[model samples]
Target: MAAAFHVRSNSFPSRPHPQAVHVDEQLIRLRSSESASTTSSSCIGQRLCDLQDLYDSLEKLLRLPVTEQTIDKKAVDKLLDGSLRVLDFCNITKDALSQTKECLNEIQSILRRKRGDLSSEVKKYLASRRSLKKSFQKVLKSLKATDGDESLPVFGEAEALTISAFRSLFSFMSESTTPSGKWSLVSKLRNHKRVSCEAQTANEFSELDSAFQSFAENKSENPLKMEDVKRLESCVQDLGEGIESLFKSLMKYRVSLLNTFGH
Candidate 1:
């Protein structure tokens, strides 16, 4: 009868007791479900953040295409719901969580290495492209001066030229085909009858009309008066503010990705 109560006096815990293991597994399942919901919520927030970051990274990855950001919807989805290797990742059963972590870590390690290589490859590509561009900077400046409106040997087509140089220098730009390949850019120059295009044409000469007035106000070698520069600066400032807001979102997502995955 005393044996029925269990006679082993060794306080040493045996390998996961069958009943304990069972209970642990159940707990793990429940926790996983709850965490999943939180993770989903976090993802929604993260996507918004990523969208903003995409905006900021634009100037950097301008060659990719504007719609498809560097972090991207896929990466952001992985950050939130994908089988991520998390640190202190699970609070399920000690045994089950430990095993899950082992599996997750192994998987993440492989991906981590691959991702690093891909990033380096992309970065190197950009650097090489930039070097080539610098060799032609003088030629490009000349073209801009004359408003050549034509492509060059190095830059390819006129529109294409803007994107390649803009990507190398400013970046914060592109998607499939490249930034300038966006439907918007293509469409901008598509119809000769577009209202905006017509408006722009009319305004092109407006600057000249203001030139004499500007010269009278303040003489300068550049026909564009101080007011024009001021207006341009103001427009740039607005763009900067939008970029800033987007940058904050990206930073937030980065923090979440790092923390959640135990980066």
Candidate 2:
């Protein structure tokens, strides 16, 4: 009877540990997923910092003085070199991003399934990258080289001249609005397109207008200082903001004149 009982017990098939096998597989997947997430997150974080640095460099380059008086070729070249280096770094980052996209996406998917924090960092990286791209485009358009010239084309020169001219014209118009006497510089300008003024107030307008015209004619003079350029740029930007469509037409006309006369 004892031998028979022992034989029956041995005959029972050994049950497979299915639950233990599943738990082990789950643990392995979780660990591999976390490892990949850490690596991708680190790469993205480093790239974001690099992009921010590039943005700063671009801002610095854009803010440099470009007035007729201070547009130094050598100095501009140095800035351009720095900017190009940043641009190159951006290219490298893009390449790295492309290469790691599959791994990043995999990690992203895993994190999303697990409701992880690293997913948010990935989203932030994408947003910052877009912002950096937009900033680079704007600065590039503003500083585009013309006619294959190494230096930025003198696009601002015409704008500066027009701004100065408008400043004078507006001053003279104000005097005309509240005339101390019967005639003023504005009256002369209105009656006969061009006229010389002798009044102290009129002379001030006259001098400003004359200086602007001279600067337009002789761009090599470089009489404009950094402050002068900044003021003119600000004035032009303000007017454009105020009357966008009209400003565009006026700017087109001014640009045409500058192009024809080589200001």
Candidate 3:
């Protein structure tokens, strides 16, 4: 019996622990599902939740003595670097969401009072969005430049997925809500009709953009609607809450990894 048990244990010498295998499967499923569809706020939120779960699983896995010993110093170093980048991305995204929320709140307040020059407020908000887009572009360029190697082990794969998810989030945010080319107010009014028709098929960001665009183009005749402002405020609040949760998860995961491997 002893000899039979020894033979059976040696037979699975190279196989990963069951929990580790499960985590790998989770990663594969996440990557496959995300790749099969376009990015949306709902999808992004789901992905963040899934990633947080994965990180929690990984933290548990790292507690295993075999997992800790299996990971080399080089791999740990890679994880540390990747963790820093992930945190940076999370912070940038959070900042963007916060700034957007603040701007929308200001617009909402102005609309509620029906007193201020709504057009000027809309312009300020648009300008802030433009600045945000520029910042996202720069960060995205750097992300692409550094994304050449992703051959690390399980932890490396997780980091890559985190980066990819953030890239998609940033790309989605950077997209123009309005159509290309500058239009005269008359032209904008004409385009607004088409935008309205398409808004039903649009994402939250697009909906908010169309609302602001319509208001900007017709500020002389139509005041900024409170309903539109409220819709956008709600969207920002949802995104802020999701990102904040993911940020906390990422921080905890990074700290856990550092504690386990930083020696």
Q: Pick the candidate with the highest lDDT.
A: 3
RMSD of 1: 26.5
- Report each candidate's C-alpha RMSD, comma-separated, in the order given: 26.5, 35.0, 9.4
Tell me the whole-model lDDT of each prediction, alpha carbons only.
0.29, 0.31, 0.69
lDDT of 2: 0.31
lDDT of 1 by residue, 101-197 (tens): 3433333343455433422332333343344335336434543464443332111121222232222212111111121111111111111121221
The pairs that clash in candidate 3 are: none
Identify the runs in model 3 with alpha carbons over 4 angstroms from their true place.
Answer: 1-15, 178-201
Q: What does candidate 2's lDDT look like per residue over 68-166, in tens digits?
A: 123334444433443343344334334433433433444345444654553344444344434444544443443333212332222222122222222
Runs in model 2 deviating more than 4 A are: 1-68, 107-263
On the 0 to 100 scale, the lDDT of residue 49 in model 1 is 30
RMSD of 2: 35.0
What TM value does model 1 have? Answer: 0.25
